[model samples]
Target: MGRRGDYKHFLPLQTRWADNDIYGHVNNVAYYGYFDTVVNEFLISQQVLDIHNGPVIGLVVETGCKYFAPLEFPQKLEGALRVAHIGNSSVRYELAIFKAGDDAPAAEGHFIHVYVDRDARKPVPLPQQFRKVLETILV
Candidate 1:
C-alpha cells in the first residue's frame, strides 16, 4: 500500500528467468527475497552490519507480505525500505517493491528483526551504531 515517497531508501533489483513460474509471473516467495535483499543491502552498505563476524546479529522473528499486482520476469524493479518501529532489541522494517519508475507498489510488507548475541542467540539491545543507522530511515 506504500507509495514511493514512503520509503527512505531504494535499491535496484532485476527479475531473473528463474524467478518466474509457469503462471508467467514472479512467484509469491520471490517477493520475500526482494524484501530481504533491500534491507540487508542497506545495512551492509552503511557499514553497520558485519554478517561474518559481528557479535550482534539480527534474526527475523516475523514477516508478512501483500501483493497488489503481478510482476513478471525480465523487468526492472525498485525495492523501497523504511523503518516502522525500533525497540530495545527489535526493529520492524517495512518494504515495498515497484516496477522501476512506477510510484505505486506492486507489493508491500514488513519484517521484524530481533537483534541477538551472535553466540548466545539471546536477544540484546541493538548496537548504538546500528540503531543510529536505522533511525535515519525511521518513518
Candidate 2:
C-alpha cells in the first residue's frame, strides 16, 4: 500500500457486472477506467474541463498499476485521486482504489497527462486556472 496521505480526494465508484472477467474478478483494465472517470469527473465538476470547446486538453502519456488485492463486480469502490507531480505541460495523477470503507487500497496506480491545444493537439503549458484546480487535490 502507498502512503495514506498520497491522495486528496475520493470518489465513489459502483462496479458493474461487465467490469469483471470470466474469472469473476474485475479485469485489470477496468481499474484504469475508474481512474480516468474519477479524474475527469472531478475536473468537470470543478468547471476546469470543457470537453466541448476547451482550449486545453489532457492527453494520457503514461500509465501503470499494481494490484494488492482482488475486487469483484457489485462491490462499491472508493477511488482516491491526487496530483503526484506537475510539470511544464504535464501532470502525474496517482490513484488508489479501495473497497468502500477500507483504509488500505486494493490497488494503486498512476497516469500522466500532458495538456495540449485542442485544435493542433500540440503540447501546451498548463493553464493557470487548471493548475489552481489541480493544486487543490495535490497531496
Candidate 3:
C-alpha cells in the first residue's frame, strides 16, 4: 500500500540471522522491532529523547502492521517513517519496510506513542524537543 518515496525519513537496518523463522523469512514480530529501533535511534540522534533521563518518555499504546512480502535474512531492511498525526501528548508514526532493491514497501505499519511523565506515568504535553524532531517528518 506504500511506495518508496512516501516516507521522508529512512533508516537502513541489518537483519539478524535470528530474525528469520523456520520458513526462512523474517518473522512478523521483527518488523515491529525495526520500527521502534528506527524511531528511537532518530530521536536519540537528534537529542530529542533520552531513554534514561528524560522527563517525558513515549509509551507505545497502539500498533498495527501489514505484510506485503516476506523478507529473508541477509537482506537489508530500510525503515521509512513519517508523522501521520501529532497531538498534545501523542504522536502517530507511520512506517514502511522496504527490502533492499525493492521499489515499494514489503511491509507497512504504524504505532502511536503517548508521551508521559516518567515518574507519574501520566500523559504530558509533547516536549519541545520532541515536537521539533517530529516536525521534520510530519506530513
Candidate 4:
C-alpha cells in the first residue's frame, strides 16, 4: 500500500462513466491507464519527453498493480508518482491512485521503463536532462 506522503508528484484524475464496468467500479485495466498518465504527465510537464520526435523513448518492460479498494465514477481522484529506482538505462516508477483527500491509496503499482533509441529500438543511457528530472522524485 502507498500513502499520500510517499509520492512527490500528484495529478488530479477525472473518473469517467465509461471507465466503470458491469461491476459498477472502475475496471482493473483502467488503473493501468492512470499509472501511465501520471508518469507521462510528469515527463511532459518537465519537457523531458518528445513523444513523436525525440531520438530516445522509454519502453515499458515490466509492470504490476495491487488493488486495496474499489473506485467508482463520480468520485474525485488523484494519481501520485515517485521514482523507486534509476539505472543507467531503466527507471522504476511507482504509482498510486487515491480518492481525493484520502491518506491511503485505493490502488498502487510500479512499472519499469527502459530507455531506448527510438530508431534502433536498442537500449540507451538515459539523457542527462531526463535523468535529472527523474531524480527529483526518487525515493
Give me the runs in candidate 2 sitting further than 4 Å from their true place: none
Q: Name the regions of candidate 3 deviating beyond 4 angstroms.
A: none
lDDT of each: 0.95, 0.91, 0.91, 0.96
TM-score of each: 0.98, 0.96, 0.97, 0.98
Model 1: per-residue Cα lDDT over 55-138, one tens digit each: 998999999999998999899999999999999999999999999999999999999999999999999998899999999999
Clashes of each: 0, 0, 0, 0
Highest lDDT model number: 4
For residues 1-139, write the lDDT of model 4, one tens digit per residue.
6699999999999889989999999999999999999999999899999998999999999999999999999888999999999999999999999999999999999999999999999999999999999999999
lDDT string for model 3 (1-139, tens) is 9898779888989899999999999999999999999889888988989999989999999999999998988998899899999999999999999987677899999999999999999999997877988999999
- Clashes by residue pair, model 1: none
Better of 2 and 3 by TM-score: 3
User: What's the distance in Å from true for residue 12, model 2?
Assistant: 0.5
Candidate 3: lDDT of 131? 94
What is the TM-score (0 to 1) of candidate 2?
A: 0.96
